[model samples]
Target: MDWIVPLILTVITASTPLLLSATGELITEKSGVLNLGVEGMMLIGAITGFAVTVSTGSAIIGIIAAAIAGMAIALIFAFLTLTLMANQVATGLALTIFGVGFSALVGSGFVGFAIEPLPSLHIPFISDIPVIGPILFGQDFLVYLSIFMVIASGWFLTKTRAGLILKAVGDSHESAHAIGYNVIGIRYMATLFGGAMSGLAGAYLSLVYTPMWAENMTAGRGWIALALVVFATWRPGRLLAGAYMFGCISVLQLHAQSAGINVPSQFMSMLPYLATVIVLVIISSDQTKIRLNAPACIGKAFRPAQ
Candidate 1:
């Protein structure tokens, strides 16, 4: 029982960044754009957040800076894809490559440095109560925010007029444009929102998850987050579930290694990514569900009428 609580806590920590990044990507795709640059944006955010926090000794400010940095990178993507009508896939890949190198360059001096971890919530009485308390209320602010965003996103997508308009753009940009919606403008906003969320996810990694600076610290989680959007069928509720599920797999792999299981360390390290591939394969078999839920115009460049 004692171990169970800690395990759940670890899972929550592991899942937070994924939830944040995936939720943002979900929104981006929902608006008829596909920014594969999530990994790059996260790296930029991680380094920026750590650098700012180190310089100013303030985690909150660091987080804000990270979000801004992410938005800045995302802005580049928006300009190329939305305004200039460049290839989203090619641009995104280039962004990721650029992020890997740029983060390494920027984070060079910050390597091997450590910072204070984000503080956990310490509610007066409730937090002290056994398992349930810690599981529900003892996490850091980002954890709570991640959960809230998912629920709020779910509501917004299903219940709001703006959500419907975004969906309209995704399903048929031409139709949406006919209906008086600014397709490119909507996508730009969505892409920026996604970048902001991705940046926050990176901040969470540096400020809370590891509380240190390292090159490529995101460790391919960005790709997993991308897959998660697909796995969840683009629904926020399902996205939440999928994130925790992946988190469990990730944590379990570590635990397996710790418990001295017979598997090789390399194999243990591969579990989470392996699970992603398997799930994707399973989901791919159901083309109907994906076709039903995925945005119709995802990855297609939108060109407004002259």
Candidate 2:
């Protein structure tokens, strides 16, 4: 019983990065662009964030650096896919490859360095509440920010005019272009937003979750975030649910191994990923939902009229 809150807290920590990254990707996809370099962008963020924090001893500076790094990588993707009309899938893959190598090169010097982790923000009176307080009020700023992003994302998509225009572009760029909306420009903004979010996610990994630097530290969390966007059927609310679900599973897998379960370590390590595959299959089995919800122009390169 005593372990329950701690476990839940761990789950929240695990879910924060996924939630952040997926929420950002959801917006990008909503604008009719599918950028697959989230993993790579995240790696770039991780290294930059770690390096900056190490240099300045300020987690905030590190986080800002991470977001900027992510946006920079995302800009490259945007130029290739939106401006030059390259294949979105291939460019994303290449971006991921580049990020992996780039992070390794840049992070090599910071490998053994360490820094203080981000501090949790505990509301004085509220955080002291028996069970609810710690769970709700004792989390770090990023955790709160993730929840805010979900709410903000939902509002932006459903209630805002700009969001409508963005969706309009996604549904049919020709129609949007006919209506005088700048499809490429809107997509560029969305792509940069996604990159920033992915970078923040990576920063969370290095400066908050683990508080250290390592080559390729993002692992495959970026891919999971991409899957999470799809699993949510392009809905921000559902994306939150899915991210937390995965987070809990990840924590459980680690706890299972620590508990001396008889399963092989390798097999135990596969649990989170296995769960991801299962969830994807389940969600994708419903083609009707996907087709109805997915952006009509997703992954299609847009060319403005001359």
Model 1 Cα lDDT, one tens digit per residue, 1-306: 568999999999999999999999999999999999999999999999999999998888999999899899999999999999999999999889998999899999999888888778999999989998999989988899999999989998999999999999999999999989999999999999999999999999989988898889999999999999999999999999999999999998879966779898889889889999999999889999999999999999878778
Question: lDDT per residue, candidate 2, 1-306, as tens digits?
Answer: 888889899999999999999999999999999999999999999999999998998889989999999999999999999999999999999999999999999998998897887989877899999878999989889899999998899999999999899899999999999989999999999999999999999999988888788887877999999999999999999999999999988887778866777887788778778988999999999999999999999999999989
For candidate 1, what is the TM-score? 0.98
**What local lDDT score does residue 168 receive in model 1, on the 0 to 100 scale?**
94
Show pairs that collide, candidate 2: none
Q: How far is candidate 1 from the true structure (C-alpha RMSD, Å)?
A: 0.9
Alpha-carbon runs more than 4 Å astray in model 1: none
Candidate 2 residue spans exceeding 4 A from truth: 258-260
